[model samples]
Target: MFSRAIAFIAAIGIVLTVNKPVISQNHSEHHSVPSPSETSAERESSRLTESHVNEGLTKLHQKNYSGAIESFGKAVEIQPSHYLAFTYRADIHRLLKNYQAAIDDYTKAIEFNPAHSYLRNSRGVSYAALGDYQNAIEDYTQAISIYPEEGAGYRHRGAAYYQLGENEKAMADLNSAISRNQKDAEAYTIRGEIYTNLKNPDLAIADYQQAAKLFLTQSNREGYTKAINLAKSLQQQSIVPDSK
Candidate 1:
Protein backbone atom coordinates (compact mmCIF):
# COMPACT_ATOMS: atom_id res chain seq x y z
CA MET A 1 0.00 0.00 0.00
CA PHE A 2 2.87 2.33 0.67
CA SER A 3 4.27 1.30 -2.71
CA ARG A 4 0.88 2.07 -4.21
CA ALA A 5 0.96 5.50 -2.60
CA ILE A 6 4.36 6.20 -4.14
CA ALA A 7 3.24 4.80 -7.48
CA PHE A 8 0.24 7.11 -7.48
CA ILE A 9 2.51 10.13 -7.34
CA ALA A 10 4.80 8.75 -10.04
CA ALA A 11 1.80 8.07 -12.27
CA ILE A 12 1.38 11.81 -12.54
CA GLY A 13 4.12 12.15 -15.15
CA ILE A 14 6.61 15.00 -15.03
CA VAL A 15 6.28 17.31 -18.01
CA LEU A 16 9.34 19.44 -18.36
CA THR A 17 8.77 22.82 -19.95
CA VAL A 18 10.47 23.15 -23.33
CA ASN A 19 12.55 26.13 -24.33
CA LYS A 20 14.43 27.00 -27.51
CA PRO A 21 17.90 25.52 -27.41
CA VAL A 22 20.61 28.11 -26.97
CA ILE A 23 23.98 27.34 -28.45
CA SER A 24 26.66 27.97 -25.87
CA GLN A 25 29.33 30.35 -27.12
CA ASN A 26 32.81 29.01 -26.56
CA HIS A 27 35.15 31.41 -24.71
CA SER A 28 37.96 30.49 -27.13
CA GLU A 29 35.82 31.47 -30.07
CA HIS A 30 35.15 34.91 -28.58
CA HIS A 31 38.37 36.37 -29.91
CA SER A 32 37.86 35.22 -33.50
CA VAL A 33 34.75 34.77 -35.53
CA PRO A 34 34.00 31.18 -36.44
CA SER A 35 33.95 30.11 -40.09
CA PRO A 36 30.53 30.86 -41.61
CA SER A 37 30.02 27.16 -42.38
CA GLU A 38 30.76 26.15 -38.78
CA THR A 39 28.41 28.81 -37.44
CA SER A 40 25.66 27.65 -39.79
CA ALA A 41 26.11 24.00 -38.72
CA GLU A 42 25.95 24.88 -35.03
CA ARG A 43 22.82 26.98 -35.53
CA GLU A 44 21.27 24.23 -37.63
CA SER A 45 21.95 21.64 -34.93
CA SER A 46 20.36 23.84 -32.30
CA ARG A 47 17.29 24.37 -34.44
CA LEU A 48 16.93 20.64 -35.14
CA THR A 49 17.36 19.77 -31.46
CA GLU A 50 14.71 22.31 -30.49
CA SER A 51 12.35 21.00 -33.12
CA HIS A 52 12.83 17.44 -31.90
CA VAL A 53 12.21 18.40 -28.27
CA ASN A 54 9.02 20.24 -29.19
CA GLU A 55 7.84 17.31 -31.28
CA GLY A 56 8.65 14.97 -28.41
CA LEU A 57 6.57 17.05 -26.01
CA THR A 58 3.62 17.04 -28.40
CA LYS A 59 3.84 13.27 -28.80
CA LEU A 60 4.13 12.85 -25.05
CA HIS A 61 0.98 14.95 -24.59
CA GLN A 62 -0.84 12.81 -27.13
CA LYS A 63 0.28 9.60 -25.35
CA ASN A 64 2.34 8.50 -28.29
CA TYR A 65 5.03 7.20 -26.02
CA SER A 66 7.16 5.43 -28.62
CA GLY A 67 7.09 8.45 -30.89
CA ALA A 68 7.96 10.66 -27.95
CA ILE A 69 10.93 8.47 -27.12
CA GLU A 70 12.12 8.53 -30.72
CA SER A 71 11.85 12.27 -30.91
CA PHE A 72 13.64 12.76 -27.59
CA GLY A 73 16.31 10.31 -28.69
CA LYS A 74 16.89 12.32 -31.85
CA ALA A 75 17.19 15.48 -29.80
CA VAL A 76 19.83 13.95 -27.55
CA GLU A 77 21.68 12.52 -30.56
CA ILE A 78 21.84 15.97 -32.06
CA GLN A 79 22.97 17.46 -28.81
CA PRO A 80 24.36 14.95 -26.34
CA SER A 81 24.41 17.52 -23.54
CA HIS A 82 20.67 18.13 -23.73
CA TYR A 83 19.68 17.19 -20.21
CA LEU A 84 15.99 17.87 -20.82
CA ALA A 85 15.90 15.31 -23.62
CA PHE A 86 17.54 12.73 -21.38
CA THR A 87 15.09 13.56 -18.60
CA TYR A 88 12.02 13.23 -20.79
CA ARG A 89 13.27 9.95 -22.20
CA ALA A 90 14.00 8.70 -18.70
CA ASP A 91 10.48 9.55 -17.55
CA ILE A 92 9.00 7.62 -20.46
CA HIS A 93 11.21 4.63 -19.71
CA ARG A 94 10.15 4.68 -16.08
CA LEU A 95 6.47 4.78 -17.04
CA LEU A 96 7.06 1.86 -19.35
CA LYS A 97 8.64 -0.08 -16.46
CA ASN A 98 12.04 -0.14 -18.10
CA TYR A 99 13.72 0.66 -14.82
CA GLN A 100 17.29 0.00 -15.95
CA ALA A 101 16.85 2.08 -19.09
CA ALA A 102 15.28 4.81 -17.02
CA ILE A 103 18.22 4.77 -14.62
CA ASP A 104 20.69 4.99 -17.50
CA ASP A 105 18.93 7.98 -19.02
CA TYR A 106 18.50 9.63 -15.63
CA THR A 107 22.21 9.20 -15.02
CA LYS A 108 22.96 10.97 -18.30
CA ALA A 109 20.57 13.76 -17.30
CA ILE A 110 22.21 14.11 -13.89
CA GLU A 111 25.64 14.28 -15.49
CA PHE A 112 24.56 17.32 -17.47
CA ASN A 113 22.45 18.90 -14.72
CA PRO A 114 23.83 17.85 -11.38
CA ALA A 115 22.10 20.65 -9.48
CA HIS A 116 18.59 19.42 -10.28
CA SER A 117 17.22 17.74 -7.15
CA TYR A 118 14.21 16.41 -9.05
CA LEU A 119 16.50 14.47 -11.39
CA ARG A 120 18.01 12.72 -8.40
CA ASN A 121 14.57 12.01 -7.00
CA SER A 122 13.39 10.65 -10.33
CA ARG A 123 16.39 8.34 -10.57
CA GLY A 124 15.74 7.20 -7.01
CA VAL A 125 12.21 6.30 -7.97
CA SER A 126 13.47 4.09 -10.76
CA TYR A 127 15.97 2.48 -8.38
CA ALA A 128 13.23 1.87 -5.85
CA ALA A 129 11.10 0.29 -8.56
CA LEU A 130 13.88 -2.23 -9.09
CA GLY A 131 13.91 -3.07 -5.36
CA ASP A 132 17.30 -1.40 -4.94
CA TYR A 133 16.52 0.56 -1.80
CA GLN A 134 20.13 1.29 -0.96
CA ASN A 135 20.80 2.99 -4.29
CA ALA A 136 17.45 4.74 -4.03
CA ILE A 137 18.39 6.04 -0.60
CA GLU A 138 21.69 7.31 -1.96
CA ASP A 139 19.97 9.24 -4.71
CA TYR A 140 17.39 10.60 -2.26
CA THR A 141 20.20 11.65 0.04
CA GLN A 142 21.82 13.58 -2.79
CA ALA A 143 18.50 15.21 -3.57
CA ILE A 144 18.10 16.21 0.08
CA SER A 145 21.64 17.58 0.15
CA ILE A 146 20.89 19.66 -2.93
CA TYR A 147 17.55 20.99 -1.68
CA PRO A 148 17.29 20.61 2.07
CA GLU A 149 14.29 22.93 2.25
CA GLU A 150 12.17 20.70 0.04
CA GLY A 151 10.12 17.80 1.49
CA ALA A 152 10.04 15.44 -1.49
CA GLY A 153 13.52 14.03 -0.92
CA TYR A 154 12.76 13.37 2.74
CA ARG A 155 9.46 11.71 1.93
CA HIS A 156 11.08 9.50 -0.72
CA ARG A 157 13.96 8.53 1.57
CA GLY A 158 11.50 7.79 4.36
CA ALA A 159 9.62 5.37 2.14
CA ALA A 160 12.89 3.70 1.14
CA TYR A 161 13.86 3.37 4.78
CA TYR A 162 10.49 1.84 5.53
CA GLN A 163 11.03 -0.70 2.78
CA LEU A 164 14.35 -1.61 4.36
CA GLY A 165 12.67 -2.08 7.79
CA GLU A 166 14.50 0.91 9.21
CA ASN A 167 11.38 2.22 10.91
CA GLU A 168 13.16 4.63 13.23
CA LYS A 169 14.98 6.27 10.31
CA ALA A 170 11.74 6.22 8.36
CA MET A 171 9.97 7.99 11.21
CA ALA A 172 12.66 10.64 11.43
CA ASP A 173 12.57 11.33 7.71
CA LEU A 174 8.78 11.30 7.58
CA ASN A 175 8.67 13.70 10.50
CA SER A 176 11.11 15.98 8.68
CA ALA A 177 8.99 15.76 5.53
CA ILE A 178 5.78 16.61 7.39
CA SER A 179 7.49 19.40 9.29
CA ARG A 180 8.61 20.94 5.99
CA ASN A 181 5.25 20.46 4.30
CA GLN A 182 2.20 19.60 6.36
CA LYS A 183 0.12 19.24 3.18
CA ASP A 184 2.11 16.19 2.05
CA ALA A 185 -0.63 13.56 1.99
CA GLU A 186 1.74 10.75 1.05
CA ALA A 187 3.97 11.46 4.02
CA TYR A 188 1.01 11.33 6.38
CA THR A 189 -0.17 8.11 4.79
CA ILE A 190 3.26 6.53 5.22
CA ARG A 191 3.55 7.77 8.77
CA GLY A 192 0.15 6.28 9.49
CA GLU A 193 1.41 2.90 8.26
CA ILE A 194 4.39 3.17 10.56
CA TYR A 195 2.11 3.94 13.47
CA THR A 196 -0.06 0.97 12.61
CA ASN A 197 3.03 -1.27 12.55
CA LEU A 198 4.03 0.12 15.95
CA LYS A 199 0.58 -0.86 17.35
CA ASN A 200 -0.42 2.78 17.89
CA PRO A 201 -3.83 2.68 16.27
CA ASP A 202 -4.96 6.06 17.60
CA LEU A 203 -2.09 7.95 15.99
CA ALA A 204 -2.35 5.84 12.89
CA ILE A 205 -6.05 6.59 12.45
CA ALA A 206 -5.47 10.29 13.10
CA ASP A 207 -2.76 10.38 10.43
CA TYR A 208 -4.97 8.55 7.95
CA GLN A 209 -7.75 11.05 8.62
CA GLN A 210 -5.41 13.95 8.00
CA ALA A 211 -4.07 12.27 4.88
CA ALA A 212 -7.65 11.85 3.61
CA LYS A 213 -8.31 15.54 4.11
CA LEU A 214 -5.11 16.58 2.34
CA PHE A 215 -5.63 14.11 -0.50
CA LEU A 216 -9.17 15.48 -1.02
CA THR A 217 -7.80 19.01 -1.05
CA GLN A 218 -5.26 17.98 -3.70
CA SER A 219 -7.98 16.39 -5.87
CA ASN A 220 -6.44 12.93 -5.45
CA ARG A 221 -9.68 10.96 -5.29
CA GLU A 222 -7.97 7.56 -5.16
CA GLY A 223 -5.68 8.57 -2.32
CA TYR A 224 -8.55 10.22 -0.47
CA THR A 225 -10.70 7.08 -0.77
CA LYS A 226 -7.86 4.83 0.36
CA ALA A 227 -7.01 7.00 3.37
CA ILE A 228 -10.60 7.43 4.46
CA ASN A 229 -11.25 3.70 4.14
CA LEU A 230 -8.14 2.94 6.17
CA ALA A 231 -9.22 5.35 8.89
CA LYS A 232 -12.71 3.88 9.05
CA SER A 233 -11.36 0.33 9.15
CA LEU A 234 -9.14 1.23 12.09
CA GLN A 235 -11.99 2.99 13.85
CA GLN A 236 -14.19 -0.10 13.46
CA GLN A 237 -11.47 -2.34 14.81
CA SER A 238 -10.99 -0.09 17.83
CA ILE A 239 -14.65 -0.47 18.83
CA VAL A 240 -14.80 -4.23 18.30
CA PRO A 241 -15.21 -6.37 21.47
CA ASP A 242 -12.16 -8.44 22.33
CA SER A 243 -12.54 -12.21 22.05
CA LYS A 244 -12.26 -13.65 25.55
Candidate 2:
Protein backbone atom coordinates (compact mmCIF):
# COMPACT_ATOMS: atom_id res chain seq x y z
CA MET A 1 0.00 0.00 0.00
CA PHE A 2 2.84 2.34 0.86
CA SER A 3 4.51 1.30 -2.40
CA ARG A 4 1.35 2.39 -4.20
CA ALA A 5 1.42 5.70 -2.35
CA ILE A 6 5.01 6.35 -3.42
CA ALA A 7 4.13 5.19 -6.92
CA PHE A 8 1.41 7.84 -6.97
CA ILE A 9 3.83 10.52 -5.82
CA ALA A 10 6.50 9.58 -8.37
CA ALA A 11 6.21 8.15 -11.84
CA ILE A 12 7.40 4.55 -11.36
CA GLY A 13 10.38 5.80 -9.30
CA ILE A 14 12.85 5.13 -12.16
CA VAL A 15 13.34 5.69 -15.87
CA LEU A 16 14.68 2.97 -18.18
CA THR A 17 17.28 4.16 -20.66
CA VAL A 18 18.56 2.01 -23.51
CA ASN A 19 22.32 1.51 -23.45
CA LYS A 20 24.89 -0.56 -25.32
CA PRO A 21 26.11 -3.83 -23.81
CA VAL A 22 29.54 -4.05 -22.21
CA ILE A 23 31.70 -6.93 -23.35
CA SER A 24 34.68 -7.84 -21.25
CA GLN A 25 38.13 -6.69 -22.31
CA ASN A 26 39.19 -10.33 -22.45
CA HIS A 27 37.20 -10.74 -25.68
CA SER A 28 39.92 -11.44 -28.19
CA GLU A 29 40.01 -9.69 -31.53
CA HIS A 30 41.60 -12.69 -33.29
CA HIS A 31 39.08 -15.19 -31.99
CA SER A 32 39.03 -18.63 -33.60
CA VAL A 33 35.81 -19.86 -35.20
CA PRO A 34 33.61 -21.52 -32.60
CA SER A 35 33.27 -25.32 -32.85
CA PRO A 36 29.78 -26.90 -33.21
CA SER A 37 30.02 -28.03 -29.60
CA GLU A 38 30.87 -24.49 -28.38
CA THR A 39 27.99 -23.05 -30.44
CA SER A 40 25.57 -25.52 -28.84
CA ALA A 41 26.69 -24.52 -25.36
CA GLU A 42 26.34 -20.83 -26.17
CA ARG A 43 22.85 -21.37 -27.55
CA GLU A 44 21.81 -23.26 -24.46
CA SER A 45 23.09 -20.48 -22.23
CA SER A 46 21.28 -17.84 -24.25
CA ARG A 47 18.07 -19.85 -24.13
CA LEU A 48 18.29 -20.21 -20.39
CA THR A 49 18.96 -16.50 -19.94
CA GLU A 50 16.00 -15.55 -22.13
CA SER A 51 13.70 -17.94 -20.30
CA HIS A 52 14.66 -16.51 -16.92
CA VAL A 53 14.29 -12.92 -18.05
CA ASN A 54 10.87 -13.57 -19.53
CA GLU A 55 9.74 -15.41 -16.43
CA GLY A 56 10.92 -12.53 -14.26
CA LEU A 57 9.00 -9.97 -16.30
CA THR A 58 5.87 -12.10 -16.27
CA LYS A 59 6.03 -12.45 -12.50
CA LEU A 60 6.60 -8.71 -12.13
CA HIS A 61 3.54 -7.92 -14.24
CA GLN A 62 1.54 -10.19 -12.01
CA LYS A 63 2.76 -8.21 -8.94
CA ASN A 64 4.61 -11.25 -7.67
CA TYR A 65 7.57 -9.26 -6.47
CA SER A 66 9.43 -12.13 -4.81
CA GLY A 67 8.99 -14.48 -7.73
CA ALA A 68 10.11 -11.79 -10.15
CA ILE A 69 13.19 -11.18 -8.07
CA GLU A 70 14.11 -14.83 -8.01
CA SER A 71 13.72 -15.18 -11.76
CA PHE A 72 15.72 -12.05 -12.37
CA GLY A 73 18.40 -13.29 -10.02
CA LYS A 74 18.78 -16.39 -12.17
CA ALA A 75 19.07 -14.27 -15.29
CA VAL A 76 21.77 -12.13 -13.68
CA GLU A 77 23.69 -15.23 -12.64
CA ILE A 78 23.61 -16.63 -16.15
CA GLN A 79 24.91 -13.35 -17.55
CA PRO A 80 26.46 -11.24 -14.84
CA SER A 81 27.09 -8.34 -17.22
CA HIS A 82 23.47 -7.98 -18.31
CA TYR A 83 22.72 -4.34 -17.55
CA LEU A 84 19.01 -4.56 -18.24
CA ALA A 85 18.69 -7.58 -15.97
CA PHE A 86 20.24 -5.67 -13.09
CA THR A 87 18.04 -2.66 -13.69
CA TYR A 88 14.93 -4.81 -13.80
CA ARG A 89 15.94 -6.77 -10.72
CA ALA A 90 16.49 -3.47 -8.95
CA ASP A 91 12.90 -2.49 -9.71
CA ILE A 92 11.68 -5.73 -8.22
CA HIS A 93 13.77 -5.12 -5.12
CA ARG A 94 12.18 -1.71 -4.74
CA LEU A 95 8.74 -3.26 -5.01
CA LEU A 96 9.78 -5.75 -2.33
CA LYS A 97 10.94 -2.95 0.01
CA ASN A 98 14.58 -4.05 -0.29
CA TYR A 99 15.99 -0.60 -0.89
CA GLN A 100 19.64 -1.46 -0.29
CA ALA A 101 19.62 -4.41 -2.68
CA ALA A 102 17.91 -2.22 -5.26
CA ILE A 103 20.68 0.33 -4.97
CA ASP A 104 23.33 -2.37 -5.36
CA ASP A 105 21.77 -3.70 -8.53
CA TYR A 106 21.44 -0.19 -9.90
CA THR A 107 25.10 0.38 -9.19
CA LYS A 108 26.05 -2.75 -11.11
CA ALA A 109 23.92 -1.62 -14.02
CA ILE A 110 25.63 1.75 -13.99
CA GLU A 111 29.07 0.20 -13.96
CA PHE A 112 28.19 -1.79 -17.06
CA ASN A 113 26.88 1.30 -18.86
CA PRO A 114 27.27 4.68 -17.26
CA ALA A 115 25.49 6.67 -19.98
CA HIS A 116 22.01 5.35 -19.25
CA SER A 117 19.77 8.14 -17.99
CA TYR A 118 17.18 5.73 -16.72
CA LEU A 119 19.65 3.81 -14.62
CA ARG A 120 20.86 7.06 -13.09
CA ASN A 121 17.30 7.99 -12.21
CA SER A 122 16.71 4.57 -10.68
CA ARG A 123 19.83 4.82 -8.56
CA GLY A 124 18.83 8.31 -7.47
CA VAL A 125 15.49 7.04 -6.26
CA SER A 126 17.16 4.25 -4.32
CA TYR A 127 19.39 6.83 -2.70
CA ALA A 128 16.34 8.90 -1.87
CA ALA A 129 14.77 5.90 -0.19
CA LEU A 130 17.82 5.71 2.11
CA GLY A 131 17.47 9.41 2.95
CA ASP A 132 20.52 10.30 0.88
CA TYR A 133 19.09 13.42 -0.71
CA GLN A 134 22.45 14.68 -1.95
CA ASN A 135 23.20 11.49 -3.89
CA ALA A 136 19.65 11.34 -5.17
CA ILE A 137 19.87 14.90 -6.46
CA GLU A 138 23.14 14.12 -8.16
CA ASP A 139 21.64 11.12 -9.95
CA TYR A 140 18.53 13.08 -10.95
CA THR A 141 20.68 15.94 -12.20
CA GLN A 142 22.69 13.56 -14.35
CA ALA A 143 19.51 12.03 -15.73
CA ILE A 144 18.13 15.47 -16.64
CA SER A 145 21.39 16.42 -18.27
CA ILE A 146 21.24 13.30 -20.42
CA TYR A 147 17.58 13.76 -21.43
CA PRO A 148 16.19 17.18 -20.72
CA GLU A 149 13.02 16.61 -22.71
CA GLU A 150 11.77 13.97 -20.27
CA GLY A 151 9.81 15.47 -17.37
CA ALA A 152 10.42 12.52 -15.04
CA GLY A 153 13.98 13.48 -14.13
CA TYR A 154 12.98 16.98 -13.08
CA ARG A 155 9.99 15.68 -11.14
CA HIS A 156 12.20 13.19 -9.28
CA ARG A 157 14.82 15.82 -8.50
CA GLY A 158 12.10 18.08 -7.12
CA ALA A 159 11.08 15.28 -4.77
CA ALA A 160 14.68 15.00 -3.64
CA TYR A 161 14.76 18.72 -2.97
CA TYR A 162 11.49 18.52 -1.07
CA GLN A 163 12.95 15.77 1.08
CA LEU A 164 15.98 17.92 1.75
CA GLY A 165 13.79 20.82 2.97
CA GLU A 166 14.82 22.93 0.00
CA ASN A 167 11.31 24.10 -0.81
CA GLU A 168 12.37 26.84 -3.23
CA LYS A 169 14.42 24.45 -5.34
CA ALA A 170 11.65 21.91 -5.12
CA MET A 171 9.11 24.45 -6.44
CA ALA A 172 11.37 25.36 -9.33
CA ASP A 173 11.71 21.73 -10.41
CA LEU A 174 8.02 20.95 -9.77
CA ASN A 175 7.00 23.96 -11.85
CA SER A 176 9.16 22.69 -14.69
CA ALA A 177 7.60 19.24 -14.37
CA ILE A 178 4.07 20.70 -14.50
CA SER A 179 5.02 22.88 -17.44
CA ARG A 180 6.20 19.79 -19.24
CA ASN A 181 3.03 17.87 -18.36
CA GLN A 182 0.11 19.94 -17.12
CA LYS A 183 -2.01 16.91 -16.27
CA ASP A 184 0.48 15.70 -13.66
CA ALA A 185 -1.53 15.46 -10.45
CA GLU A 186 1.56 14.47 -8.50
CA ALA A 187 3.26 17.68 -9.52
CA TYR A 188 0.29 19.72 -8.39
CA THR A 189 0.29 18.00 -5.02
CA ILE A 190 3.98 18.63 -4.49
CA ARG A 191 3.67 22.24 -5.59
CA GLY A 192 0.75 22.60 -3.23
CA GLU A 193 2.94 21.39 -0.38
CA ILE A 194 5.63 23.89 -1.33
CA TYR A 195 3.10 26.70 -1.32
CA THR A 196 1.78 25.57 2.05
CA ASN A 197 5.25 25.59 3.49
CA LEU A 198 5.81 29.06 2.08
CA LYS A 199 2.71 30.24 3.95
CA ASN A 200 0.93 31.05 0.68
CA PRO A 201 -2.38 29.51 1.69
CA ASP A 202 -4.36 30.88 -1.24
CA LEU A 203 -1.98 29.42 -3.80
CA ALA A 204 -1.78 26.15 -1.88
CA ILE A 205 -5.57 25.90 -1.83
CA ALA A 206 -5.74 26.63 -5.54
CA ASP A 207 -3.24 23.90 -6.38
CA TYR A 208 -4.90 21.39 -4.07
CA GLN A 209 -8.22 22.20 -5.68
CA GLN A 210 -6.75 21.50 -9.10
CA ALA A 211 -5.37 18.17 -7.92
CA ALA A 212 -8.71 17.23 -6.37
CA LYS A 213 -10.52 18.08 -9.58
CA LEU A 214 -8.18 15.91 -11.63
CA PHE A 215 -8.51 13.02 -9.23
CA LEU A 216 -12.29 13.25 -9.29
CA THR A 217 -12.32 13.31 -13.08
CA GLN A 218 -10.19 10.16 -13.12
CA SER A 219 -12.46 8.47 -10.52
CA ASN A 220 -9.55 8.32 -8.06
CA ARG A 221 -11.42 8.61 -4.77
CA GLU A 222 -8.33 8.20 -2.61
CA GLY A 223 -6.36 10.87 -4.44
CA TYR A 224 -9.34 13.17 -4.41
CA THR A 225 -9.78 12.72 -0.67
CA LYS A 226 -6.13 13.49 -0.04
CA ALA A 227 -6.23 16.71 -2.02
CA ILE A 228 -9.57 17.79 -0.65
CA ASN A 229 -8.47 17.19 2.91
CA LEU A 230 -5.30 19.16 2.31
CA ALA A 231 -7.29 22.10 0.96
CA LYS A 232 -9.76 21.94 3.83
CA SER A 233 -7.03 21.84 6.45
CA LEU A 234 -5.35 24.86 4.85
CA GLN A 235 -8.61 26.76 4.90
CA GLN A 236 -9.18 25.87 8.54
CA GLN A 237 -5.76 27.26 9.37
CA SER A 238 -6.93 30.65 8.03
CA ILE A 239 -4.35 30.80 5.27
CA VAL A 240 -5.99 34.02 4.17
CA PRO A 241 -7.26 36.80 6.45
CA ASP A 242 -10.64 38.48 5.86
CA SER A 243 -10.30 41.30 3.31
CA LYS A 244 -12.90 43.26 5.34
**lDDT (Cα, tens digit) per residue for candidate 1, span 1-244:** 2222123224445421111111122212322344566777787787788778768766776778899899989999999998877877888898889999999999999998898787888899899999999999999999889888888899999999999999999999999999988899999999999999999999999999999999999788999999999999999999999999
lDDT of 2 by residue, 96-184 (tens): 67889999998999999788677788788888889999999999999888877767678889988998899889999988888877767
TM-score of each: 0.85, 0.78
Q: Where does model 1 exceed 4 Å of error? A: 1-12, 15-38
Cα lDDT computed for each candidate against the true fold: 0.81, 0.75
Report how far off residue 95 is in candidate 2 (Å).
Answer: 1.1
Q: RMSD per prediction, one decimal?
A: 7.4, 7.6
